[model samples]
Target: MHDKYASVVKILHSEASDLMSLAILSGRDPFRFYNGADLTSLDLTNQNLTGLNFDGADLRFAHLEGASFDKGSLNRSVLDAAQLHLKDGFEFNYQDVLQFPGKEILMFCMIRSSLIDEILIDFGINYSVFAEFSKISTGALRKARVGKVIAIETAQLIFNGVFRFSKTLDSKIGMKCINSIEQPCAKMLVGGNNKPFVEISAEDVHRLFEIRRRRIAHMKRERGTNASPYVDYRDTAEYLMFYKHLVDDIDFWTKFDEESA
Candidate 1:
């Protein structure tokens, strides 16, 4: 019986190692190998079966005491009359988050509570300027601040606004800055095909004005302009991009917690 159990375990590992690894990393299914396998009355005692996928497998009257497995190894597997021992400390199920009935609202709230302010502060932008530039309605912004769920269309508008504003800023700065230099040139980059002059767009002046507002806000807190992160001339001249989005909120948040820990 012991020899038979070892052979079965070896064969399963050989066939499904990659899939099991993927499932563990992604919090997804890894049961392709044992989707419908029968291992009735088998002795798997004291075995190390961590991260294995045993979905749809039969384990009736199997001796599984002291066998080690990850939180999700036996998901969807049958365990009628089987001796089992499950360890603790398996909290925060990604599946539960996915199955949540109010997940959409939760996502919207998260964005409104954190992402909007984060983007604005990172860009040194004021609420009014951001609203005007992003074309986000004042009402919608107010609703978002109070934790009210905004429409999907409004959320999309905010995202597009961030993307477009970043791109426009990049274009303006790129035309002004010289190669390998942080500051913009004195003259605009246009006209004769000689040495390129920096093209200071109207947007540049507006950004500088916004930076001044940011500096003023900092000064009110007794931090002063010197304490501001965006006080340098390069701050207005430099271009930054925002190119990423949250595709899997659960996965993203989980990774965030792990890294912070």
Candidate 2:
């Protein structure tokens, strides 16, 4: 573990300058620093990140297999490509108790797919159909919309789900899936309201499915190696089940089609 820590520290220190701008050094004392930094693509495998408050940090592509975060705070941290595993008979808690502060929040609790789908339809902010799933010439579309750009909040939700369950899938496939979801979501928010109605490309949609594939791979691995049954990340499954909710929100805003001032 010491060796692992050394490697992680070296990488962080060397690249600290570049990352400092992206790092969130908030609060004070035990929970008073670095709440939501972006530490993506760093190798922190098998190190002890226990009790660290990474409450909204982007830890995508970080190697954390067998790492100890037993009591660490990752409330809203992004773990898209991170690897996690339990140590000798140790049980890891995967509960998402972190409160993400925002208005356009997207919550996905574990439940049946049908129920999730219904909930998404009820809360979505856009009216655009998931073009990838249905034909462009489908029946009449719904007119409900939310008229606000909530992509950032929604993206974080998606990232959290990918990170929490990434370790279960094949590394390559998992990374691809995470990138698929994270990229467009990030892009949508870059210009904010200026590009509110930006369409997600076909490539991006494919990436979402890739996430599903990787999830299945992870489930199979857990069942075959650990004797545990296949369990998908309830959060992610729920989000996908009710993704249309976000679509509704976007569509509503587009109906007005007023440019951002």
Report the number of the highest-lDDT candidate: 1
- Expressed as tens digits, the lDDT of each residue in 112-172 for candidate 1 is 2444554565557777887787688877865654535554345445555665565555554
**What residue runs in model 1 are displaced by over 4 Å at the alpha carbon?**
1-32, 82-96, 99-261
Q: Which regions of candidate 2 fall more than 4 Å away from where they truly are?
A: 1-27, 81-261
TM-scores of all predicted structures: 0.26, 0.25
- How many collisions per candidate? 6, 16
For residue 246, give model 2's deviation from the true position in Å. Answer: 15
CA-only RMSD, every prediction = 24.3, 20.6
- By summed lDDT, the worst window of 10 consecutive residues in model 2 runs over 88-97
